[model samples]
Target: MNTDVDRVVAHLDPGPGPGMTEGAHALMREIITAEPAPAPRPARRRRPVLRLALPGVALATAAFVALSWLLPTGPGFGPGPAAALDIREENGYYVVEVKDLYAGPDRYQEQLRGVGLDVTLRLTPSTPSMVGSIFPTSPTDHRYLDEIKTIDQPGACEKMGGCPIGVKVPVGFQGPAEITLGREAAPGEEYANVTSFDALGEPMHCVAFRGRTVAEVRELLAQRGLAVHEFRDTNPYIDEEAASRTSVPDSWYVNGGYLRAPGKANLNVSEQPEESDAGGLRNCAAPQGS
Candidate 1:
């Protein structure tokens, strides 16, 4: 009997961690076959004891401890600050909400990228009624934005705070989109805000010339004797990476371009390949403290 038990014990050779080799299973089989039947003997009182395979139990406990150490903890176990914008799909369009009042435009654009749309939001001062308006064209374009016309204000939600902005973008829209919001004017001001088109006449729309570079647009405007002032590219995603105004001319940047509208010479150029996603080009006198 002792020899049979020794044979079964010899077959066991546990590997590292929880991985048991085929030899371990064979050992278990041998243990079962080598066990001797209890012989008839007088029953003797003995203290109750719990019997368990210490090696297998210890291995399982060690594996559990190792997994616990590897598991992540804390707030969702990701990187970066909490996103200030919330994006959701409603009907057929994507609804983007601004949860933070001072959230940077570039961050908003970054958050939108995950939504599969190249939409952006900028808080530009506008008339009270026209506040929270959508501008699909460059600042030079006088064509009215019809996209905002389609959106209806929704009932206030619990999450919406002071800077509640809901922008509806089409599902398949891949290009850039900008939504301009009207900023509240400071004290001693009668009205809330102003826009580029508030007082100035409708500027020339440049949808026909989308691919032209800033230098090309500048040359075109110069040929027409239109003075383009403060030419700057407007792409929220690349805004931070843009060269300094003193370092490089606006023509150097490859995205949408904006010019200070001197007098009535209407000239606005967007770098976006599509005319639908362009704006921020203009020379408007912004109200102070707005």
Candidate 2:
């Protein structure tokens, strides 16, 4: 009995079109009354009568259109198939589950484009603790940064050092941004992100190598069946490429280190003691001393 329903019913022509069955008419009535009338809009020219060979299909199509018109058509409510990526709408966010982590980057871009997002995805090799984490290239852009989030399972994330299993993007995001997802590294592949040497699940976790002599750290690494691949200076101003190639004496102090590969470690060493140990040791002391 709603005014919108009355208008829709008035538009239905009972002329020389295919005859709808009694069941089809009943379904049409149910669909029309399924929701309250929507707000009135400006009048438009009437549509021409639809002449169809299939009476039931035509009536059902009309009923579906009416039902869809009554439904909300907001940002997250738009219609799209969930293929390639399992994208679901939840609380103004699109919960996206990547169907194939090993898929080429172009495949990911194509799927995201299908869902109205302008995103680029990169799957990068990572350390154990960092696997499944999400990183956005534009870290300074807070406009969309806060809306992009990682989705995780209840206990699975905790077991994996708190790494997420999925990603979430805002329904209304208009991005030209690049996103990186951490994935398990293949054998002999270096990690893309530099995790702390002592970070949970890292190869050197709990190993006290900080402020030790390079010779002493080498001995410690040898004991753990690991070897130094290269030594880098702890100074932030030093050029990394030049430092990696420069020869470092065994007496230089080891400030920090990280696993570059399965059995290879890259140490951060300096000629002078680190700032924290400036007063503790003027010279690189024996490895026995911290």
Best by lDDT: 2
Off by over 4 Å in 2: 1-84, 88-92, 137-144, 155-162, 222-225, 234-242, 245-247, 275-290
Q: Ten-residue segment with the worst summed lDDT in candidate 1?
A: 50-59
Worst 10 residues of 2 by lDDT: 51-60
lDDT of 2 by residue, 1-290 (tens): 11122111111122212223344334334433211111111123221221111100000132232111111112343334533344557767665555455567676667677667776666554445445444343322422244566554344222112434445677777776556555565676655433444444455545667677889888988877789876667666766444553359989997766555567776768887676643322212222323
Highest-TM-score candidate: 2
Off by over 4 Å in 1: 1-81, 126-130, 138-149, 154-165, 185-290
Per-structure clash totals for the candidates: 2, 0
RMSD of each: 34.1, 25.5
- Using alpha carbons, what is the TM-score of model 1? 0.31
C-alpha lDDT values of all predictions: 0.32, 0.47
Model 2 backbone overlap count: 0
